[model samples]
Target: MSNPAVSNPAASSRRAARAAVAAPPPRPTSAQASPRPVAALSTRVPLGRRVAKKAFPPAVMLAVASLLVGTSVPANALFDPDAPPASMALSSIADAKVAETVEVEGQVIEAEAASDIATTAASRDAWTVTSYAEMLRLRYGSTNYSYNASGTGPIRWPFPFAAPVTSGFGDRVAPCRGCSSYHRGVDFDAGYGAPVGAIADGIVTAVGRSSSFGYRVEIEHIINGQKVMSLYAHLIDNSSVLTVGAPVVAGEIVGAVGDTGLSTGPHLHLEIHVDSVPVDPFAWLVANAG
Candidate 1:
């Protein structure tokens, strides 16, 4: 029992406990975290962003370009170029009408205009073109063309009759004239009942009575794939015995002469046409007749 020198076990135990609690445990070493997944995420996000940035511009440009290209195409087709031009005679039936220009084609079954007008069907379709460029294209195009300026190839008599030509081609309007209009043909004074022969080889295109020319006959001839039509006016009634589509030789008798179709007297009114344009019969006769 020496009270002054003795230590208390509880207090000593408490103090030991306090000291143990106060001392810190050894810290863990600074081990780094595994970075594989984080690096993958970082690379993936950036690549996706970069690819999106690269693709956007080209796609927009392509869309814009397609819109522009669509608007440039022409709405309607025009006539073709690079083909040779065609010519039409001045005396053509087509030339006599409201047509100052004619369009010739390769496969024309009938002349663009005719002495006998259209009766059964509608009138011929006149091309209503918009511009001169289009008109030129029609003239020069392979399928369409302007009337040939030249006369029908090697003009011979539409009907064989002698010529010192009492009357000529052009307007023959006298006050007393019965036909009383632009004479669509030329008058050749031949004897009544003369045997009228075909000028060239042709088909019997038309045969009938006309108001102006009392008895009329028309022939369609082909030369070098061009159409040449001839009209014989003032023929004797019922003289056109040959039916349509009958072939006749040059200088073959087509009809007999008589005063008809507003003729002042018995004579032959001959018209020479090439691609439907009227031309001077005398010049044609001089150039091509035998």
Candidate 2:
């Protein structure tokens, strides 16, 4: 193989060139070797991005991780720097020990009782959400409205306290624009949503809404060997007892005080009819109720 190629000068030169092209260069020593550039970056690239792309030393990376952990600990409770891939929720609740307070053993500590129940009149009313003196004075001149008299019957007043009466039965100056001058019922200025109870134990005769009465309930009872009909008007529409023949006992909450009919404000318009004749409730309740 060498005989013809070695002898010819042109062929020899061609063989030497081929050998140089085919053979790899000698390996460089550690001293001779130079570090390679990571990438060729443009000046237009963001400084932060360029820095992020470049490799960092172990100490610098460790410092960065430490800073992240310190800052994120408060913001993220589950953050963990030691565990692989950082912190995440544990697989099971049994992985962590329960707190002494959370898992109570024995001897439960009871809370302290309230100190004092009594307070100032204004504070007491504010706390209980009850107000009346001012409203009564402005509406009916004084706070007293004359429902305080007691009688010895199975009947009970609608309100537990002495409620203010705005108008009496018979005749009065029209209270509202469309109100009747000849008033037939007694208006009790019980506060809004105040419970209205049945006057006596009786059977409900009527339960409906009308323009004249506006959400009223009528009950029939035999009082003192006389047929007395009691009508509770200006009541909230959602009355508890709706059945006609429902037997109601005295002092049971039948309806709530409201402003539904031809009225001015929240009150209960109670009308008592003795043998179909309208009578003054004040005179009757004073005479009958004990």
Candidate 3:
């Protein structure tokens, strides 16, 4: 044992020299070392793989969703990876259809509206519509299209809009007692009280009532250098205010739709007479009306 106060410089120098020459620490053995943390030695995964779950194709996602919900999925639905969702595809088709319809309608107007607009709705809807591509239907469809277009011609259809024909100009069973089995006029179901118009520039030849026709009106016009007569019957009572021999222009209001004189329902019976012979009113109007 050494005294507490005694200084040992030589001993300290010898101890420092020994420590400097000491052997390096023994390398850690596999068994003696502590095990590494599980997180620190994790297997490397690709960064792209981490984000791939969200990048699955829509079809594949749909199949998986269907399975999760216990719904059967079509086999073809899962195979297509490039196809868009059905809603998106349908929306795109709708947009294309609307665009094409607009273009076709504009072109149709330019082609049909040469001298008058009255001919456009009637002619385009009747004839040229067949020539158009079947897929590109008119935006202003037949039911919605009106015949109110101004006409610079001597003739026009009687109504402001196209009225559906209830009865054709031909032989048919009588609709009511005292009604003629052999039809002489075309019956238009233009709704009750619908305004009737003159088919052409003409003078009122006759206006009266009868047992077969509730209220009748007759007008004579010189069409294409021939005497053409038009008859409107089954008009509402007291609707024909114009007296006999009153001047009327094309599309002049003559009367209103009504059920009278052996009629079953409200409708207009239109007749066309050429050379005192009854002809098909529908055919004559379609051929001659502007």
Candidate 4:
């Protein structure tokens, strides 16, 4: 109903009323809030593996491989090139024109004694090497000396061979390995059954079969008013050419050569003795004849 507006003072003002709307929505998380501190989580297995690799390195395997290779080498391979040379040393004989005699292989190599041209008389006292038990002394003329100074002797074969050597004198040979016993004779490597003649005129003294010397024969001769004896060893079997009392001349065939006793091969072992003492046959040959 319409009511009449009366007296106007207070007026009931009539206005249109509108519905209230909400503000805009906020974000899902707070944008301006302080962040929280995170807790630390340790990974120990990877760190331990790294530390083990550093402590026991792959280089240890390489070192072990090198040591194994070094131990496998042989010891003898180190010094095989240092062995001694095999060639033997021998003393050389030069042109010995001036010297009366010289030593070769511990025996005297001598020439003939000086002869007087006026009467052809020979001087027996020329040169010799003293053969003794302890030492060897070389004597030249009347003067005696040693090898290191100067000396001489007769030409003698040092080694044994198969031949006819007339003079049997001083041959230095060891009967035993350590003992210094000489072969008091010159051996002739004359073939078996070859004729062994007398080197000088001598009388047969002993002829018999011996255990050490086989069929042996002894001859006694005179030289420069001195008695010299000759011994023949290892004669031909059963071939008798002389009796014990028979006299033989130089170069007279007396026996045959054979290998009978204390011999390695077929040869004639001849020995010459002065007053029953052994002397170098080569020296004797030079002194008696040129």
Clashes of each: 18, 4, 0, 18
| Cα lDDT, all candidates | 0.66, 0.73, 0.76, 0.57
Task: Give me the displacement of residue 206 in model 4, in angstroms.
Answer: 1.0
For all predictions, the C-alpha RMSD in Å is 23.7, 22.8, 24.5, 24.8
Query: Model 3, 96: alpha-carbon shift in Å?
Result: 66
What ranges in model 2 sit over 4 Å off? 1-144, 149-153
Error of 1 at 24 (Å): 99
**Candidate no. 1 TM-score:** 0.44
* Model 1 stretches with alpha carbons more than 4 Å out: 1-155, 158-161, 175-181
Quality of model 4 by C-alpha lDDT = 0.57
- Residues 1-290 of candidate 4 have per-residue lDDT tens digits of 55555544345333111112243556557877666654323434587888888878678988998798779867765655665432211101122321334333332423222112211322233555645532421221222211120112222221222244532343343543442245576666657787766656778998878776778788887867889887888886666578899987766666777877666667777777888778865556545532
Q: How well does model 1 score by local distance difference test?
A: 0.66
lDDT of 3 by residue, 1-290 (tens): 78633577788888888998895877889999998788766876777986775566776989888787565656666668898776556555555555555577555444333324333434565663353323223321222222342444678877866888777765565667778867888888999999998988889998989878879899999998889999999999989888898899888888999998888899999999998899988777767777
Residue clash pairs of candidate 3: none
As a whole number from 0 to 100, the lDDT of residue 5 in candidate 3 is: 37
Best by TM-score: 2
Count of backbone collisions in candidate 3: 0
Best by lDDT: 3
